[model samples]
Target: PLGQLPVLEIDGGKFPQSLAIARYLARQLKLGGKNDLESLKCDVIVDTMQEL
Candidate 1:
């Protein structure tokens, strides 16, 4: 089941999936790490959560 919406604001955009929104924020904040490896790790974790 889908989770509740997060009570956060963005630059004139709203994202339904909290995890996706988090990833976007991470990228924007430069906390997403340096290279493909970091991105892949993030993707894997998100995928794993979805699979659960």
Candidate 2:
């Protein structure tokens, strides 16, 4: 409902922004990266792909 793109819903609350939502879920699930540097690299790749 918040625009045409998909959003994250939690406890009946709707959250916009795909990237932020994804990052939050990744962190919660411990799937972001094993280290900070790895996390940074993952973020870069995800962001780059999002831009394309």
Candidate 3:
């Protein structure tokens, strides 16, 4: 069974783009926003950071 190991968890996976990963995590955590306006603000901050 060593050759066919089960995927118990994903420890370290590389993200092609940091921004995309950040956005995904934000959404998963519900840290992005509860409504349209807050979501827009979260997106703007992400964009600003990416610009830098």
Candidate 4:
């Protein structure tokens, strides 16, 4: 399915991929970790969660 549902449209451009799109929006809205260590932990959780 090339035309996916979870697409991120920014500045007149479009980006796809589920996890990537989620991460981009999370970073944009400052909804993720607060520091390097926390960010790493968050990334691990996200990666593992995506696998499931």
In lDDT terms, which candidate is top?
Answer: 2
Off by over 4 Å in 3: 1-14
lDDT of 1 by residue, 1-52 (tens): 2445763456675557767776887898887768999988887887787788
Estimated TM-score for each candidate: 0.59, 0.81, 0.68, 0.74
- Model 3 C-alpha lDDT per residue in residues 1-52, reported as the tens digit of each score: 1333222223574445556767778898999999999999999999999899
Question: Which of candidates 2 and 4 is the stronger one according to lDDT?
Answer: 2
Mark the regions of model 1 whose C-alpha exceeds 4 Å error after superposition. 1-4
Model 3 clashing residue pairs (backbone): none
Sorted on lDDT, highest at the top, how do the candidates line up? 2, 4, 1, 3
The clash tally of candidate 2 reads 0
Candidate 4 stretches with Cα past 4 Å from truth are none
Looking at model 1, which ten-residue stretch has the lowest summed lDDT? 1-10
Tell me the alpha-carbon RMSD of every candidate: 3.7, 1.4, 8.3, 1.9
Provide the lowest-lDDT 10-residue window in model 2: 1-10
lDDT of each: 0.74, 0.84, 0.73, 0.80
Task: Write down the lDDT that model 2 would get.
Answer: 0.84
Give one digit per residue, the lDDT tens place, for model 4 in 9-42. 8888878887898678778878667988877887
Q: TM-score for model 2?
A: 0.81
lDDT of 4 at 4: 82
